[model samples]
Target chain A: MSTSEGGDSPGEAGGGPDGTGDSGGLRTTLTRTRAATALTLRRRDSLSVVTGVTVIYLLGYLWAVGDLAPGFGGYGLVLAADPLGGLLRTTSGPLSFAPVALVRAGPLAYEASLNTLVGLGLALLVGLNLGLTYLTRKQPAACGLRSSTGVLAGVPALLSGTACCGPVVLVALGLQASGVILTAFQVLLPAAVLVLVGSLVAVGRQVRPEAMAAASGSGARGSDNRE
Target chain B: MPRLTRRRTLASLASLGAAALAGCTTDANTGGGGGTVPAADDRLPLPIEPPALRDAAVSGGPGKDGIPSIDEPSFVAPAEVDFLADGDPVFGVARDGVTKAYPQSILAQHEIVNDELAGDPVSVTYCPLTGTVLGFDRGATSFGVSGRLVNDNLIMYDRATETWWPQILATAVPGPWNAEPETRSLREFRLVWTTWERWRGQHPETRVLSRDTGSPRNYARDPYGDYNPREGYYAGGAPLFPPLREDDRYGPKRVVMGARAPEGAVAFLKDGLREAGLLSGQLGDVPVLAVHDPRYDTGYVYRNPDELAYESVDEGVEGPAGITYAPDRLPLDRIHTFDAMWFAWAGFYPETDVYE
Candidate 1:
């Protein structure tokens, strides 16, 4: 029943230089910390790349929808209003050209602020992925969470797509592009909210199960061995 | 990692500053009323020879008093008089040792004419602004009488009526008595007679008349019909016209004649014109004869209301000071319709013997 034979073998302990119990314990702790840090870093890096790519994709969708649709359709009011909506709009229909389209619509001031905010949101998503990836590194079954996180990250961009669709269209057709930037900001707001939620969940999981259990269990075992 | 470089930041700031400065500079003459200039060629054509008087003998000579004079000749029919479309002809009068003439033709066009003649202060006055003519006699103690021409059709007051007339045209208004008359007094009428007198005194080359020996009257009754001499006749009534408001009276009175003054009167007019931007740099050095007398009441005649009112003082008063009449009464402010007055001195040229 004990993990010492197979599940908790010497190799599983991530072997240390000295064979003493204290040394093994210390080595195990160090290896776990390093593994967690590496996993977090890798997840963060991937998330950053994914978020950045998503922004670029959203921009394309905004551009295309704005160019093709008439009136306020290009502004994508629905996408801008909700995070999921923005992501959906970006991924859906022939309106995939929003991002690139917004750039051509006007000068830098119109889009720079909203784009910066979006870029920040995407960065946060990368951070979240790093945390989640670090937590599940030892368990392959939990690896599926990465794809779900990615999908969730896309929701904001989709919502931004819908909300900004109308103004984006106007900007594409030689109208004021500032409207699109403004609408995009509204759409991306929900993404910020979601990122906050993800951060809280990650912190709770880290402290509640892993850190508390390890601290109490180690304390009791030490007393028993001494007795 | 390296910090951002200062060189790039400075270059960006400089470009922005340059762009802002460029937006402020604009052309001055790009808009509104200043763009258009009036055409100078809008004057009537001049006539060659003015018409002659039918009864030349009676109206031609000077009276027994030695001043060049015009008698009350019968009013000729409008057809008999060859009216020039633009101007009236010059008339002649021989009196005393001098013979002087007035060119109504030129006077009609200019309305106000100035000149010097025959060693005497004379002016052939007409107010083109109000279409009134009077003879100013400066020889009689600097106060003249109203001359009678064509059976009193043209009356110029002499020393007798100096105190009662308002010289400025704008000051004249038609009152209850002589309000609705067909004729109105010209504000600048004094200039015509004064110009004639100046010509006579400066240039004896035209000796039309010697100084008259008869004593000039200080006051006289109104001779024109329906114009009462007593009941508020002359300036004895309320000011025939209202005082000029401070805002409307832009500048001080200009002395275009007589002695030169370093300040006071001259400075007053100069300051006014300068503020208006109408001063032409330097003042003209012509010696203008400034007569600050109240005898000339330059007024207008209004047809609707029957009254003799003074011209408003809004425009500087000019003309023989004693005559009275009004033009029209405006509705909004209840102000009198005022006109311009021409006051000048006329004299005869002995060599040419005609009033030029």
Candidate 2:
């Protein structure tokens, strides 16, 4: 699903048609990233990668945030008194939402919240980044995307999970919480998303349609990479 | 059982007048066990004004009811429980021939357990940050974690009136939900903060709170820290949030046997009470006695207005008449007391008299 290498790199060396530099390049990179991300989703292998990573990351995210945890052996479900109203209620932090329902089965229990949606969005972004990274690796010499980009972007998202419970993680580590640290926790989720999206663009802009097509003996798909 | 209506306000004003009168008496007798605090009602002295305390309430991560209360709490016998270690802390309460234990591990996850004890509704609350466990008469409505803290203590809100009541203070303060609560206090009871082994050994037939709380939580994992060995937040010198007031006389996590009344507050160092077996101090001008229970390693505070010189004997505490009495069964009027972190006690009652 990768495009062939094109010498026309967006952010690195280009100027806008009107002569704007960095902003124009960034816009072009984002445009190409959107196309590349869509292409990665359309392919079976990359789609599997996206799905697998998304599921694993979402589970890990829920576990870290304490929404999904081990339960006493049981099979039951419980809903909050006002589950609908609970959907939008904020809990531990700005982004953390209250659980509206609890679903327990066998060894695991999950508390349903708007946080699951938040985590799903983040997990999908992480999955797409890794999926693109996987494509780049398939044509190693032909691509400049580092394999570590997706992994690095995912770390902060995991840390943001602990952000739900204030300084709970800090307490476990025997670290004192300060105003600066709490402020950082409030921004961790948003920062992680921005970094993941930024990573996707950086990796996507490196793909050259002609080079990738020539390497794989297929027609060039650069123009077709657009929205 | 009355709402925060105008009539209650008038009643509170009358009570406050009586408290002021008692305060005047207390001011005259400032030395050893000498003054008298108003008789026990629900009211205890507030360190500051109610409005100031309301303004000081800060978010402790979760929102109102964010940390769910065990509204329909269930209990099991000692042999049915396997989650608690011998050294693990348990909040033990005995009332009207009924004895129960709420494990610290479970209470850490769910701060308030609304249950009935001896046919009376009560809420067993534990605050991990302040390291305090208290029991309150819930009456018709249960209490929940407001997810708010003042001076690093839990600010509980009654479900019926949505009144903000700080767990340590046991007094109502205005909050956003109910801006003009009558400033009344909740009836409080003492819960001995002792080890599971100690409580179970003392009350082998006592019922322990079941882990089958309706909420889906890993009771094994305490978000703040552990208590059996006392590590993480429980043992930390610095609190999760800044306290309302700071005192350096004792370590922040140091345990103190604290009690307060309409007149004033007093704290006896737990270590001091344990070593001396009996410590004497004055609360606002009223003399008080603290007796250590060797079995539970806990202490009870009593208003010693008669200036009784009780001594700790192998059998129990020896009163003025040389009659031996159990630590918890003293002849003097007992003041509801509980174990609290030194920081929490000092932060809530900065003017508290300390018996080191």
Interface RMSD of each: 45.6, 2.9
> All candidates' lDDT scores?
0.26, 0.76
lDDT, residue B237, candidate 2: 64
Tell me the lDDT of candidate 2. Answer: 0.76
Q: Score the docking of each candidate (DockQ).
A: 0.00, 0.39
TM-score of each: 0.19, 0.81
Query: In candidate 2, residue A6 scores what lDDT?
Result: 46
How many steric clashes does model 2 contain? 12
At residue B316, what lDDT does model 2 achieve? 98
Predicted complex 1: CAPRI docking category? incorrect
Clashes of 1: 185
Candidate 2 lDDT tens digits, B162-261: 7788999887789988788665666778899999999999999999999777654566667777777877788766887788888888899999898877
Model 2 / residue B312 / CA error / Å: 1.7
Q: After superposition, how far is residue A200 of candidate 1 from its true place, in Å?
A: 7.0
Off by over 4 Å in 2: A1-5, A10-31, A38-60, A67-90, A97-117, A134-141, A144-152, A173-183, A216-227, B1-42
